[model samples]
Each structure stands twice: as structure tokens, then as C-alpha cells.
Target: MSVVHLHLPGFSFGDVPVLGPLTLTVDRGETLALTGPSGIGKSTLLRIVAGVYPARGTREIAGRMAFVFQEPTLLRWRTAQRNVEIAAKVSPDTALAALTEVGLGACADRFPDQLSLGQQRRLALARAFACDPDLMLLDEPFVSLDAAAAEEMMGLFADLRARRNMAGILVTHDAAEARRLATRTLTLSGRPATVTADVHAAA
Candidate 1:
């Protein structure tokens, strides 16, 4: 099934064009990665697809969707478990299970400030998973983590994707990260960004 379909005639800032005409689709259980230079409108395109940014286009998304930003964006006053429960609108039991799945059950009572950066990212993943989304949108989700932490987080995400069979769109500048996580990658470039390359990973 097609999880997302976007046909963007174009997108622009007040006077400058950010993205040119484009069309893309993601199917069930597929991970599509968008890679491009910084400030090249990759994130902007993501927001447009998420309906967080208004644009003139045909944006169709099927089933439930969840987004994980570069930052964890957790509530500072809420405990880890509570963050998941509130953001995901899930029961306490479901939230706890989600925490456990992300290796955060032991720190469920800790607030965002108390957990390390990597742990906070895990909490974000837990919250997203608890929503039981059919499509997951991630924007540079592993940006600041150290090598080991990034690897672990990638592994966790891969496992979750396998278990849930969820479609995903990942935005990253790292080609290696895209190859590792995405089944297909689209590279955007030019003055008004457009897909310049579409490569499928070797199975």
C-alpha cells in the first residue's frame, strides 16, 4: 500500500524558491531517505509532507503518522514514561512497554534533564513507537550522537521497523547513514531543489 504521496509543484520562501517541481511516494514497509546539502530545503520538504508547512501541492498520507525531530523535544517537566503516555496518547501500560522496547524502562521515572542525550533520543523513539504509527518521519534523528550511540539507535530503529512493518522517511546529510537505514535514497540538489538521484540499496 502507498503510505505517502506528494506532488509539489514548487515551494518558495518570500522571494526565493526552495524546492522545484517534485513528486515522491513511499510504500508500506519501505524506508525512503532524503539526502542533500545543508540549507537545501530537505527539512522544509519534510515539514511540507507532514502538513506542518503549507504549500501548494497534492499531499496524501495514509494511516497514522509520527515525527521525530532532530531534538528529542520532550516536555522538561514530565518524566520519561509520562512523556510517552502524553505524546502518544497511550495507556500507562503501553507507555511502559514502549519504554522497555527502547531500553528505557529503568529510567522511566527520570525527567528529560536527568537523562543523557542518547537516552533522551531513545525516549523520543519510544514516544513515536507508542503511537503505533503506520508511517514514521525522522529529521536527522541521529545528528549529534557519538559513534556508538548512533549505531545503537540505528539498530533499535531497524528492529522496530522490522517488527512493525512501518514505512519511514529519513532526512540526513550522511550518505552512509542513508545507505544503512534506507532501502532507497533520493538526493536533492540545484538552486531550487529537485531529486537529482534515486538509488536503491543492494539487497
Candidate 2:
């Protein structure tokens, strides 16, 4: 089963202090929504989970993972499908199919520069889903979209998670969105952020 456990001590990034101390667990099929004031090391936490940064405490990730950053992070030179194909290390057909799931099938041949901001975001989701990861790390995946588009993307995220049984950590500032998408929501506080509140969705 997919699982994650993190017990990171107070940490700093460069000269900037990040998180104080945090202990969290995510089991299979759980999406933990993390929220805080901007720049309170929300993304930093995701990076730590992704194993891109070193932390002082024990951290364990027990499954394949995929990440979707705040930015699309696509290759400007590559077509949408090609980008997913390369990053996900999947067949072209599989990549295209993932894009289709995110409503980007018709834009498969377009480059990142040619797609709208929302399309680029969808492309990023396509790449993540293409990997068929057990865990998903998402950082503001719905930023800069109209309400309708964001809602659609949210539905797509739910659909993908159900199809794959993926566990996830979503960093979002929108409380309502967090409540809508996550099984539980956590709020961080202080200079070196720590979880101040955790609320579970109603069954």
C-alpha cells in the first residue's frame, strides 16, 4: 500500500527559515491538503517529500510518485504529448490518452508556448497521470484559471485519483478548494511553519 511519513525538524532554506517541525502521515487513497500564508514553505514541504531537499528528520515514501508544480514546467520546445511522453517515460499513445483524460487531447500537438495557461496546467496534470504514480504531489495545480475551468480540473483530479487509488498532498491557499478535494486539511502557522489545525471532511 502507498504510504508516507515525515518527521522533519525545524529547517532553513539558504538564509530563510522554512518549517519548524512537522509530523504527518498519509496512507493509501488519502489526499492531505496543506495550506498557509504565501511563502510559508508550502512548496518547500512538497520538495522535501519529493526528496529534492534534505531534511533533519526521518522521511519515508513507499511508492512511485509524480509531482505537479505551480508552474506547468513543460518543455517549451516540445509538443504537449511529447513532453508527457518524455517526462512520464510512457508510450506516445499512453501519453496522448492521459492528455485526453485532462481535456487536452485536441491540443496534443501544441507546444507549451502555444497553449493557454489553463491548457498548460492540464498538460502538467496529464504528465503526472501518465506516470501512473501511487502518490501525487500537487502545488497550486489550479492557479490562474476561471472558476469553471478550475472546477473542471478539480473534477479531473478526483477522477484520476479514483482510477489510480493515488494518495496525494495538495498545497493550496483556497480553503474551500481544500475542503472540497482533500480527505483532510492542514493549516500551517508561524515563521517556521508547523501544522496548527487539521480538519477532516465530513463522511
Model 2 worst lDDT run, 10 consecutive residues? 1-10
Q: Which structure among the candidates has the greatest TM-score? A: 1
Give candidate 2 regions above 4 Å deviation. Answer: none
After superposition on all C-alphas, the RMSD of every candidate to the true structure, in Å, is 0.6, 1.3
Q: Give the TM-score of candidate 1.
A: 0.99
Model 1: per-residue Cα lDDT at residue 163:
91
Q: Tens digits of per-residue lDDT for model 1 on 123-177?
A: 9999999999999999999999999999999999998888998899999999889
lDDT of each: 0.96, 0.90
Assess every candidate by TM-score.
Answer: 0.99, 0.95
In candidate 1 the C-alpha lDDT for residue 178 amounts to 97
Error of 1 at 23 (Å): 0.1
